[model samples]
Target: MNLPKIVLALGYSGLIPFFIGPVWLGFSPETAPAWLDRAWLSWAALIGAFMAGTFWGFALPAVQGPAGLLGIFISVALVALTGIAVTLEFAHALAGLALVFMLLLLADFWRERTLDTIGGYFRLRSTLTAGVLIAITWRYLMLPAGGA
Candidate 1:
């Protein structure tokens, strides 16, 4: 179970949102006010950059011990932060991110079953599960409020 591969997978997962953001936002910058468009694009770029960073952070051979743990923590934190952001305005986006995150975590777990000893496997699984649960709950919670 190599740590680098797991990180790469998670990092790639970040790209999902990058591609979706434009379409989800209707890809009409003109429709939104200048400030709103700029803010949305900035946040999207931030998510993409974090995804790339997560890939390298976990992949670097020089990173070991506590540093590896830190990498995982940062990845989880990014997922949580993104979830919160999407939940606040776009519940559907939150759900989509949750699905992507869960799939990425599953792939990572499969790649490094033995590395479960290193604290990466279980922690990632738990975080992914939490994200999914939150997304599902958010979806249902919005139903009563005319989420459809």
Candidate 2:
């Protein structure tokens, strides 16, 4: 099924923050605010947590079985990972968030196979996740040689 226009709009708009970090740093790596990387990392973690919650919601109907339970467990773990990511040193935190995003996508792919989910959502997720990953890598590359 097709996603609603609003959902598409909101989903794509969510990518803006992901790009902001790289773009800002690219333009002014030397003069960018000291908190810029941290802010970007924080935003990534927040979005990751939100996505995890959505994963939990998607997995709810399957709660009667192991698949559902596993999904819920994964969701919780993702949130925890994101929380941990925010507390680490900048480079470590960026790695952690990237890992979390990858895991979340993998989980959603699993969910698509094992449970009911909104049609078109996974495709959108795949696209958005790729964009996120690119932004993350771009930002990472821009980090100082010793890391932020």
Candidate 3:
């Protein structure tokens, strides 16, 4: 498939675990099965890595290679680090880091599109990412800690 299609697929796939992670494990932090928690976290990290790699692949050509890859790596690192922090019971710090990353992602999207004069592809990707984050927070975090 083409670059944009691949980016979109990666973006959508990365969203899956964000939705599932909190719902399956975050909500039931105390009761969730160890295996299930491990499975969900692993899925989330793998999908996140795939998304980051694909994003860099699409961006590299536009950003002159190394810079694009570096940006993607940093973004992935932030996500993974914050995820670990969250899992370690640093909710406030994780929330703060997530906010920073979200803002950075938005800024990067804007800069890339403006500098490259690209189409609406970045906008669509950003929208999808934001939607997924919102769904994760609202659907999962808003629920009681261990409820159906």
Candidate 4:
């Protein structure tokens, strides 16, 4: 189905690095460079923060109620966790990022039941999140110290 072009564009735009970073790393040195690792981790943390903020923005327009309050808290926690996660080891950070995205997708899916998002919003979110998770997990395994 045709989803909102803006959402699709923004979503995929955010996803490109997560998708491409892994692919780029795969073709690079067997032992990935320190700079590349730092760069990808930085990008992942930034994107995670941005996604959490987007959810917070959605809560702003929502009616003052339990759902809106919950959304706000979820969004905030997502950022908080991301901040903490980024400071951890690279392997830990990837796993944390994967969890963060899963929680984000779940939060959006749950929020959509009560609040109004663009049509097919959940589908778009799920697809992008799944793609991100896959890329991260794949890269995680590829990391020398990460699980294989």
Candidate 5:
């Protein structure tokens, strides 16, 4: 299916914040700035929550069925997970958010295959997810020996 230009533009541009964390850390003369880590984690957590809402929207049509209910449940659970991730220490929070994003990508994949069958959407999500994971990994590696 042909995706709207707006969707493609927004989806890819959304990744800018994800990459900003690593880029900021890389340019720092010493360690990451006081707010850099938290900023990055917060951005990730927010995105995770946003993804959960999209998942919920996808499940709306099937709300009468068990799969739809399960989908809704999982979407809510992802928001809770995202909240918990933000409360953790830096390294753990990074890992947690990464996992949440991956799960979101999986949910999108499931939706594509079973729910909507949107052609380019899942591909875009996969690419964005990779970008997010890469950024998270980059920041993780930049952490101090034992992690900050």
Candidate 6:
């Protein structure tokens, strides 16, 4: 699909950390850089938070309904995930990031139609989240007993 250039750029830009970390890490098994691992978790959570913030903004204008309720849930999840991402391990953080995206996507699906062009946002999210989850899960799977 032809998405706005900004959306396309931002979506792929967000995936940079997820893509770079594993691909680069896969080569340096013995002594991997700290930034790769940190970047993956940080970017994942950052995007989750960014999406949650957007949802919250949209939900305020919406009345009490499924979308609104889910927005609330997304906010709560964001807080938990943000805390988890900081205190817990990278794997745990990735899982939390996935949960935030799950809730965000759910909210988006149920949200009321307001704009003329809406479907593309969902399409972008579906692709981005799938890539993110796959990349993060692959990182978790490829890691040594504890972590890299």
Which candidate's lDDT is highest?
Answer: 2
Ranking by lDDT: 2, 5, 4, 6, 3, 1
**In candidate 3, what are the lDDT values of residues 17-109, reduced to their tens digit?**
666656656466677675654464355445444444554555556565656656666556656654563354334433544454475466456
The TM-score leader among the candidates is: 2
How many clashing residue pairs appear in each of the predictions shown?
Answer: 0, 0, 0, 0, 0, 0
TM-score between candidate 1 and the true structure: 0.35
Q: Candidate 4 — number of clashing residue pairs? A: 0
As for TM-score, the candidate ahead, 5 or 6, is 5
Question: Would you estimate the TM-scores of all the predictions?
Answer: 0.35, 0.95, 0.51, 0.86, 0.93, 0.77
User: lDDT values of the candidates?
Assistant: 0.48, 0.89, 0.54, 0.81, 0.85, 0.69
Better of 1 and 6 by lDDT: 6
Clashing pairs in 5: none
User: Which RMSD does model 6 reach against the true structure?
Assistant: 3.2
lDDT against true structure, model 4: 0.81
The residue-by-residue lDDT of candidate 2 on 1-148, one tens digit each, is 8999999999999999999989988987778798887788888998999999887898898888999998889999999999998899988888888999999899989988998888899999999999999999888887788995
**Per-residue accuracy of model 6 over 20-116 as CA lDDT, tens digit each:** 7778778766677666677667777777777767666666655377656666666666766665765676667666676666766665665535412
Q: lDDT tens digits, residues 47-138, model 4? A: 87888887777787773987778778888999998898888888888888888888888888887886657678788878888888888898
Give the clashing pairs for model 3.
none
Global Cα RMSD, each model: 12.5, 1.1, 5.6, 2.5, 1.5, 3.2
Per-residue lDDT for 45-142 in model 1, tens only?
35523542554445355246654555565456555655554555454554554554554455455434422344454565455455444534533453
Clashing pairs in 1: none
Candidate 5, residue 76: the lDDT equals 97
Task: For candidate 6, give the lDDT of residue 73.
Answer: 64
Across residues 1-148, which tens digit of lDDT does each residue of candidate 5 receive?
Answer: 7789999999989899998888877886366677876777888888889988887888889889987887898799899999998898889989898889888988887777666556687888899899999999998898889987
Quote the lDDT for 29 in model 5.
33
Please rank every candidate by TM-score, starting with the best. 2, 5, 4, 6, 3, 1
